[model samples]
Target chain A: MENTALEKSVLNKRKTKSLILRFMVWLCGILTVGILAYILLFILVRGIPNINMEFLFGEYNSDSLSAFSSIVTTVEMIVISLIIAVPVGVFCAIYLHEYAKRGNKAVKVIRLAVDTLAGIPSIVYGLFGMIFFVNILGLRASVLSGVLTISIMILPVIISSSEEAIKSVPDMYREGSLGLGATRLRTVFSIVLPTAMPGILSGVILAIGRIVGETAALIFTSGTNVLENPTLDLMASQRTLAIHMYMLASEGLPYSKDMAFATGAILIIIVFIVNFAATKLAGRIGGLSNGK
Target chain B: MESIKKSKFNDTVMQSVFFMSAFVSVLAVIAISLFLFLRGIPAIAEIGFMDFVFSEKWGPVNTPASYGILSMIVGSIYVTAGAIVIGVPVGLMCAVFLAEFCPEGIYKIVKPAVNLLAGIPSIIYGFFGMQIVVPFVRDNVGGNGYSILSASIILGIMILPTIISISESSIRAVPESYKEGSFGLGATKEETIFKVVVPAAKSGVLTAIILGIGRAVGETMAVVMVAGNAVMPLDKIALLKPIRTLTTNIVTEMSYASGLHESSLIATGVVLFVFIVILNASLSLIKFRSSRN
Candidate 1:
């Protein structure tokens, strides 16, 4: 009788533990969903109403914080930064994956450095840019400084992604080109690069997303003034959408609050679009690699 | 013969180009380190290390200036702890749910939502926190709204994406045979998942939490917007009191700061950098051990 009673108690304990875990699982899942829904809805509802034509295309009026010039600066920075970052990042990735010998100390050092760079805070990048580029390089507080800083910031993302892409290409492709008596340079450019193009493109796209949303790094390098000079000149201080929103929020202008929200909404939408495209590209590449 | 020579020359050129590209990352890292330390160390020496770290007062503009980072250090620790407490359980469960329980249709929606959270910029997060979270706190708990609690909530939300994705992948990567073994022993599905799969993914879970901590500690803009940027230590256990963190201390003052004050802020960045380095080293150590296993 005593053994039976003990067994019953043990069974009850097991049941109670299982029930609690199950409840936790359901509760946490629901909370995640709820919080995500609330944030999305809060931003969209508050921001979408303020995004009129004037906000999108209006002239830069400092008092109002219209985002047109900010948007323009965002696009220009993206272009300039990408121009500098892509070729270099892609080539670096290729050297690591294809050319560098395994177990090489220099290669290991480079990898560690890149990883360290990746983990540093964005604000640190701002500090470094403020000191190195703006002060030391005599670039001053201009778009050029911002572009260089952001390019370095995004370099790790580009290199890591491109390296993975290049590594995924089967060795048989390289071997076949070599067997056909093609030079290594011709084989990589003509045969390997085309195969890895989709993946590289996706990496570049993600870099664009990062460049557009970046703020702290841009805070000092890019300067705060939203320029309406309507030029691609890199010397002028310019504000991207993210910085514009930050400036508005901190300065406590009652009228410009909605404008900040509106810029934020647009920024989110752009990031969402870029991320979607990236995942789709990555998925297609995954499918292709599996098929091979 | 001429063509062969030409091909060899082209190969050399391309290899050098790629090598130079690879060298740039290393160059940038060296440059950053030299600049940060070269400029940061002198400030500490001039200001006195003990005074810089221990003094509770921060008055750079005063006639007799004082630079103490103890409060901000405590504040960073407090807010990060709060974030981990609030974020970890929910993030882990959500990860488990995603890996084990979600229906395909629901998974589709949930997955993208998490990704979008990551994709959204911190500045946008700050706006949301400022407009929504800050006010909501004021209405409910009532401490001027921008407080440690506010920073914690925003940061906790910010970290969810990192926690969920990493943990989900790690959980899914657990060998199927382990689960089957647990099931054959007459354990329930929840029991097997909790007992078997979670333990197998333990290191990965730790990595996720660490990564989340690193993110929460380093986060600046969102925290700045909601944290209220008070430069004093909390006298009591109050989440509603505003506090300053290391990253925010640097960004807020760096705009106008000059001379020793500027270097002190950079010195603060030095401290932040050291914290991140420690976190990264621990992460890589875990990774190294796991790979060895």
Candidate 2:
């Protein structure tokens, strides 16, 4: 009887609760992937067929320019914001990761500051952009305002990611460069930066994705009117694709609904391509670093 | 000798360059705080604190227009709470699966899918919610499709990436020794995970939830699209009812608003700023405590 009881307990060791738990986990995992697939396929199915050159580049009235200009504005925002943000962010990372002494109070404060900056909601950034850039600084609801605002919004992200990249440059590389009579500055610029370029580029890609997709912060700062004739005037208000999508949808104009979907589809495609590349690059970095 | 001198000079110049660059972040934060206060406070003062925050009459276009944001505040809270309810369980489950249950081949696909979710822009999510969830709500649940329910569903989906990624990392950070010990003690795998492993990662999971709330609360474009954005009484609750959040309030009205109305919107931003700051402080405190432990 005792032997039979032991066998029965052993047979029942894979409990029903465990089975249920396993099922739930799988259900959730599949559910998450399902939701993602649904969103992508749904949007693409509706958005892709609508996308045409006319939809993309043509103006509402033939007299004015079209969704094409929003694309232009997005590019301008990306370029201008990155130009301002990248160097400063990289240098700040350098100071934190390399120059600052370990366990220092100042470094700790700065580290906390970056985290705080990261947590602050993007809408708050919008208000700051409006008050400081658009009003006080007289940027006047232009591309310049959007650039300045987005630069700040992306700063903490760039700093944190770039710091991680810089940190991954093994101490031996830095020591070897310095031991070869290279100045500290020379070691960072010539050796460390080059080796860390892939990682930094991946961070920049992420930042670009963010800049392209952002709408709310840019709404007040950039202002949502697409320029009639695209020019190099950073002072002129222009729409981004995301803002265009928002405006078109919110207005509930029957004619513009398909255009909004097409724009969303285009936006999704761009973001997807960039994201896929970043993951591949990150994977490569992992392999390279592991090999080293 | 000349080269050595030049190298020393380069170090000084680059060092200062780094200093100034780092200072830019600090200066920017200070400027944001300064400007928000400088612009936002006077508007609140002019409106009166009780009147600004307590009254629900937000019709700035009406005769003797009012600027109270109580309804918007309630709308934000309701939407955020609903998101937390909808998002946290699914996200936490997905995190646990990824951290422990996922097979290698499945892991690769699952991981990228989560990243893709994160990468998809907010506006697209807004569009998706507007197209799908909004209509579903309107049809099935009654009332206009653009309700708190619609915003909640979208925000819920949007916060999944944040919650899953952070919670997964925290679960992974749990020491292998603890799990092994649980196994040796004859705990079932589910028992070990639920009773031991998940508890060990409790603070981290809490951090994830908090961060998710922050994301949901701050979200503007998506919420504006789905939430009906009506200024209504807070005492009566309806899932299918239209309501305005603080974000949509500012975004919707700012374009047409002028004079005191504009300032009131900036003041609305000030209230949001305070909410976010409090959330950040709590999140960091949690992190600090967890690190100490």
Candidate 3:
């Protein structure tokens, strides 16, 4: 009787410990989700009321209406940078995936270079932009300089992600196309590229998100003057939304706090929209693959 | 024969384009390195390297334009160290629970949350820190609104996603056979995890930590907001006082700076670049060794 009771108690203790362990795991998962939700909710609540059409379209003034110039500048930079980066990045990804063999030293060097570039700090890119584009090339605080700098900053991300996307296309497709007597270029451009388009689009969107949100690189390369709707001239320095928000928060002028918060809200919305679009595109691609 | 010749020509052209693409990326890296080195060397040569690195006075605009990056470097180290201290354990534990202990439904939710965290911009993080952390620390820690402690906390939060994701992947990559073997030896699940799995994933975990360090070191906007921007290095008495980091110092001073001062700030960039190069090389080496082993 004594042995039976002792064994029963030990079994009961083990059961309780296991239950506690299970509960702890559930609690951790809940806590992580809770914290993230809380942060998103807090920002949305604080920032939403401040966002308005005036805020999106108005000129930048410390005293009067909201600064929309920053938004325009940001969009311009994004367009210009994408114009440069996407073609180059896609071409590079194609080169790596389609043409290069496995054992080439040049391929190895390129891989290492891209990895290292991705690891380098944004501020260093900004510094380089300052010296090379602004000084030597004489872009002089223009949107062109910002575009050049940001292109280099996000090039690795675009290339690597697009390369992965392209590589994920099965070898069977390539073989079938070639067996049909199609040229390699024709095979890649039609069969592989279209199939990889969703992934490439997703990569581009993510890169755009990074470009829109970036501050450090822009600060040095793009001059922080808040102009109202900049023109095609690349030499004029312009302020982006992030730079505007930083300036407002740090400079401590009148009504700057309100403007900064409002700008932050706009930035959040823009980023959220871009991120949402990218996620949706990725999901659609995933679904298509699953359907196959 | 004609068709064969055409195909060969096409292959050559495509191959050349591939080679050129690869070469351009390498050229970019070389150009960046060269520009930074050429612009930065003059300032370092003028300042005498040791004093430039170790001295505390950072004012580059006063009578003599005294500039030493010592305090900023210390501040960077202090904050990054604090962030690592807070981030690693929590992150590792979270990773453990996620990989080893969680059920499928729970994993689904938790995984997306981590991804979202990783996706959020750093500027928003800075805003969050300013609005939440700074006020909380000022009210609770008996300091003014900005301090190294606040910066550290924010950084800790910022780096958590990286740590959790990387560590979780590593822990998951731990072979299942090890777990079965441990179980067969009459080990409990907890013992199997703590003993067998974590050890197997040690190098990966170490890599995660190194990556976290790199993030913390390179982070600028968030640190700029919370670190109070003290130009000079603080004494022990002023540990809670705000101080500049190397990145922050460069950002803060670059606007009004001219001549050697501007060049010295760029030199700061050189220092930052060197640190990143060292970090990348070490990480690659570690990864290489780990794979080989």
Candidate 4:
């Protein structure tokens, strides 16, 4: 009878322990999801009401603080940065995957540099851009300086993702091209790159998202001077959308709070679209590369 | 054979182009390091390294300006520790839940949610902190809205995606054999996970934590918005009071600062850069040792 009683108590303790652990895990999961939902809902609910046609396209007066100029600057930053970064990044990835030996010293050094660059803070990038691009290079805190700084910033993202995509291309395709007496360059360009295009494009989209969302790196390099009219003279000092929202929040003009919310809403919407597209591309890449 | 010779020449040119492109990142790293040290070390030398790093006074405008950043260092450490404290356990549990417990339907919702969290810009996070977290802390936890505690909470939230995704993948990577052996020994699922799987995935979890630290320490705009940017003496620093960090020190003063004041800020950037290099080195060390094992 005493033995039976002890076994019953031991079983009960084990059951209780399992129950508590399960409860805690579930609680953490719920909390994680809940936080994201709350932040998204809170911003969208308050922000969507304030965004109208004028808010999107009007000039930034003391009363209105429109985002039209900032929007144009944002697009220009994205385009210029990509044009400079994409070819360089794609070529880097191709070299890593196709040209370098597995344990080559240069390959190792390149990987380390990429990792270190990615780890460096955006704020540090901002400071470097300020000192080097803005002052030393005599760009003088223009959009061009910001573009140069972020192009370096987003290179690792592009290189790593593009490498992954390139690495996934079946060797059979390469072997066949060479079998047909095609030059290695021709094979890579015609067969491998096209096959990896969806993956590479997805990575480019992710880099775009990073550029769109960056703030600290742009503030000093780009300078937060708002243009009265939309212009794309790379020399002109401008603020991107993230910086615009940051300035609005920090300066806190009377209507700035409402305008900040509107800006935040717009930023979130862009991110959602970017994330959705990247996810879709990633899904498509799986089917394309594997099915072939 | 003229066409063949032309193709060979073209290939040689493209290969060199690719090699040059590949070398750019290495050149960038060397250039960044050289530039930062060249510009930043002068101020450190002028101020004296011991006085700059160890002293707490940060008066850049005083007649005899003090350029010490000890308080900011302390502030960075405190908030990062606070973030790790608040974010790690919850994130670990969430990772385990996703890897071990969540059904397919819920995983679909939770996975995208985490990605969205990662994608949200820091500026938006700053605004969120300003509008929401500051007021909540002001009312509930004491002190003014902008406090170290407020920064900690926001950073903790900001780092969740990094910690969760890395930890979840690591947890999933643990071998099925270990779990099977645990189950064969009459261990419960929870016991098997915490004891068997988690212990196995410790290095990866550790990597996640180190990366989270990197993210939290390097974070600036969100922290600046919430962390009241008060340059405090070492003794006066507290959780509910405002504080400055190394990154914030540079950003707040960079606009108008010139001469030594500006250089001192750059020196602060040097300090931040050192901390990041150390973190990155340690992370690589962890990865190397783990792979070897």
Candidate 5:
């Protein structure tokens, strides 16, 4: 009878401990999710009521230039930065994965440099942009300057991500192609790249998200002029959504406060879509490859 | 012969372009560092390096335009230290909970939520802090709306995702055998986790803390929004008083600044750059040592 009572108490204690552990995990998860949901929900609640089609696709009012011009500039800057960054990032990834040996000193140096760049603060990047691109290159707060600055900002992210993707392509495929008498270049381009395409696309999308959200580097390099839309003239000064929102709050423009919230909502939505799509694509590709 | 020539031609060009791209990417970092150092040297020499660092007055507009950055340096340390004190323990505990105790479904939901936090823009964080944290601190902490405490709270929140993610990965990497061994010895799950698993993952946890410090120190927009922009020092425990950090000082003053004022702000950039370099180097070293072990 005593032995039975002891067993019962021990079992009860075990059950209680499990419950306590579960509760702690749930609490941690809830806190993280709660903070994110609060941020998103607050912006949507405050901003969505104010958004309209005109806000999405309208020209700037001179009185409140930040709202309209910033959207246009962000898109133009993304396009230009991608043009420069994507090619360079992909090429560097290709060299690191395909050409460079593991122990090569130059490869090691490149890796270190990329890692350091990834760790460097955005503000320092802003200073560099101000000195090199804006002042010395004399681009001077133009859309072109913003493009150059952000391209560098996203370079490390793209290269590292793309390299990981490329590296994940199975060695069996490479060896099989070579055994079948295909040239190394042909094998990499046709077999490996297609296999790695989904991962690379995900990396590019992530870079897009970073570029759209960036503000600090843009503030110094891209002077806060709200041009209506991008033109062929790269020298035209422009404002991004983030920079516009910052100006609204910091400069204390009462009229444009709602507009800033509206833009913030839009930016968040855009990032969410990109992140969701990239994750889905990568997951699908991963499943298919593993199944094969 | 023609086909062979075409194949060789393409290979050579592709290889050269790929190699050059990698080389250029590396060169970009070296070139930027050299440029910043060179451009900043004249000003540092003019101010005397010690004065440039230790001076308290930062009026870059007056006749003399005092360029002391001591207050800004103190402000940076205060906010960052405050953030570390709050963020590190919560993040580490959360990471431990996720890795050792959570169910699979909960893990999936929680991990992505952390990722989402990381994905949110700094500007959005700034706006959130302005609307929420500023009010909370003013009412509860007995301060005005904008304060260093407010900035620190916001920054702490922003850095939580980074700390949690890195630490969780490290904790997960702790060998399962260690936990199993403790369990066999009649240790409770909590005891095993605290004694064995955490000790094994100590280096990784250290690395996460370092990364968190880096994030808190480098953060600009959110800190600037809530830090009250007051250029003067406050009295004892001045949560309500405005403070300026190095990053904020540069951002706030760089617009209308010219000549010596501009140079001094650039000097702040130099100082910030050096601090980041040291932080990153240490982080990398920790990461290297941990991975090797």
Candidate 6:
């Protein structure tokens, strides 16, 4: 009888301990979600009121603090950086997956370089950009300098994602193409690339998201100069939307805070759209690859 | 015969093209290191290596000007340590919740929320810190709004998605047989998790923590806004006092900095670069060992 009573008490203690741990787990999960919700709502609620049509499309001046020029600059940055980074990144992925022999010294060197690139902090990239692109190369704080810097920064992102997409291509596709007398180049172009396009494009979209949001790297290279009239000149030093919001906030003018909040709201919306599109595309890649 | 030969030549050419493309990243890495060292080493030599790195004074405009970064280095370490303390436990618990305890319906909501958190830009995080966290700290805590405490909280929040996603994936990767074996030994679910499953995923969890450290230390725009940009003396450094990190030190002065001041800022970049390289090497080591196991 005494032994049975002791056993029952031990069981109760174990139950209580498990219950407490489970409660802590739930609490932490809730806390994570709660913080995200708070920041999102806080920005959107205060910012939505300040974003008028004029704020989005009007000329940027000391008075209105419009964002139309910055919007143009952001788009240009994305397009230019993608144009340079995507082809190189995709080709690098193809070489790693299809061309290089396993355990090759060159392959190891390339892999290390890619890994190193990925691990580098953005501020370091900024410093490098300032020194190499701006001063040595004489690009002089132009969009071209910034674009070159950002292109290098996003190369790893593009290469890794494209490599995964390329790796997922079924071996049978290559075999069947070769069996039917297609050349190696022909098979890769017609068979592998077409199938991997969706996945590669999804990666490109993610890189676009990175380019759109980048600030630190661009600050020293591209600069925060706002163009009174938006233009496509690569030589012009212009600020993106993120930089605009940062400048407005840091300037500490009386009205700049409201404008900064509005600009931030716009940025959040763009990011949400980009994130949604990438997720959808990534999901489609799995389906298309597996369904075949 | 001619067609096959011609096609073979085409393939060779294309392969060379791809190889050159792969070499670009390698070239970029070399270029970055070379430029940083070349620009930075001269300044470090000029400042006297020991005085530059270990001394506390950072006055750039004084008659003779002193350029020491010991305080900024300390500031970086303190904020990173604070971030690790605050972010790791919460992130680990959340990971456990998602991997083991979350229902399918809740996972859908939580997963997207975490993704959105990762997608948010650092600039926006900085702005949010400027508006919300800094003010909150000033009112509730002892010192001014902009202090080490505020930067830590923001960074801790910022690193959450990184730690959670990495940890959750590694936890899920733990083989089912391990959990089943623990259960068969009469271990309850919670006990099995903390004692058996988490221990099994130890290397992966360590990787998550290290990556979180990398992010916290390298973070710039957000830390600048909340860290008050004041170069505090080493003895004066406190949680509630304004402090400058290695990253913030460069940015706060880079604009107006001229001559040696500019070079000194680049030297600061060189120091930050070394820290990242060390972190990266350790990460690779962990990955290599785990893969071998």
Please provide, for model 6 over A1-292, each residue's C-alpha lDDT reduced to its tens digit, 9 standing for 90 to 100: 9999999999899999999999999999989999899888888898889999888889888888999999999999999999999999999999999999998899999999999998888899999999999999999999999999999999998999899888888888999999999988899899999888878887898888788878888889999999777888999999999899889989988689999888889888888898888788778768866765
Q: Taking the tens digit of each residue's C-alpha lDDT, what string does model 1 give over A1-292?
A: 9999999898788888988898898778778878878877887788888898878887777755678888888999999899999999999998998889999887988898888888888999998999899999999999999999999999998998898888878888899999999998888898778888778888988899889889989999989887654457889988888998898778787777877778777887898789999888877667666756
Candidate 5 lDDT over B166-280, as tens digits, reads 8899888888899899999987787677778888888888888888888887888888889987776423336566788888988888888888778888888888888888998
Q: Estimate each model's TM-score.
A: 0.97, 0.96, 0.93, 0.99, 0.94, 0.98
- CAPRI-wise, candidate 2 is medium
User: Which candidate number would show the highest TM-score if scored against the true structure?
Assistant: 4
In model 3, what lDDT does residue A120 have? 83
Write down the DockQ of candidate 3.
0.48
lDDT of 3 by residue, A168-260 (tens): 787888899999988887788888888888888888998988888788898988877876554556777887878888887776654676677
The 10-residue segment of model 3 chain B with minimum total lDDT is B231-240
Q: Considering TM-score, which of the candidate structures 1 and 5 is the better prediction for this target?
A: 1
The parts of candidate 4 lying over 4 Å away from their true place are none
What lDDT is reached at residue A187 by model 6? 91
**In lDDT terms, how accurate is model 6?**
0.92
TM value for model 6: 0.98
Candidate 2, residues B129-229, lDDT tens digits: the string is 98899999888988889898999999999999999999999999999999999999988998899889989999989999999998999999999888877
Point out the higher-scoring one by DockQ: 3 or 5. Answer: 5
Question: For residues A1-292, could you state the per-residue lDDT of candidate 2 as single tens digits?
Answer: 9999997787576587788898998889999999999999888888898888866776555332257788888888899999999999999988888788889787777777777778777788888999899998888999999999999989897898788778778788889998998888999999877777777888888999999889889999998887665666899998887898887777676567877777888888998998988877656556655646
lDDT of each: 0.88, 0.87, 0.81, 0.92, 0.82, 0.92
Clashing pairs in 4: none
Error of 5 at B229 (Å): 2.1
Worst 10 residues of 1 chain A by lDDT: A283-292
Measured with C-alpha atoms, the lDDT of residue A101 in candidate 2 is 82
TM-score between candidate 2 and the true structure: 0.96
Q: Candidate 3, chain A: TM-score? A: 0.90
Off by over 4 Å in 6: A1-4, B1-3
Residue B240 of model 2: what lDDT?
Answer: 88
- lDDT by residue for model 4 (A1-292), tens: 9999999899889989999999999999999999999898888988899999888998777667889999999999999999999999999999999888889999999999999998999999998898899989999989999999999999998898889999889889999999999998999899889988888998899999999999999999998999777899999999999998999999876578888998999999999999999888877778876765
Clashes per candidate (backbone, < 3 Å):
0, 0, 0, 0, 1, 0
lDDT of candidate 6 over B201-267, digit per residue (tens)? 9999999998999999999998999999899999999999998999999888888999999999999
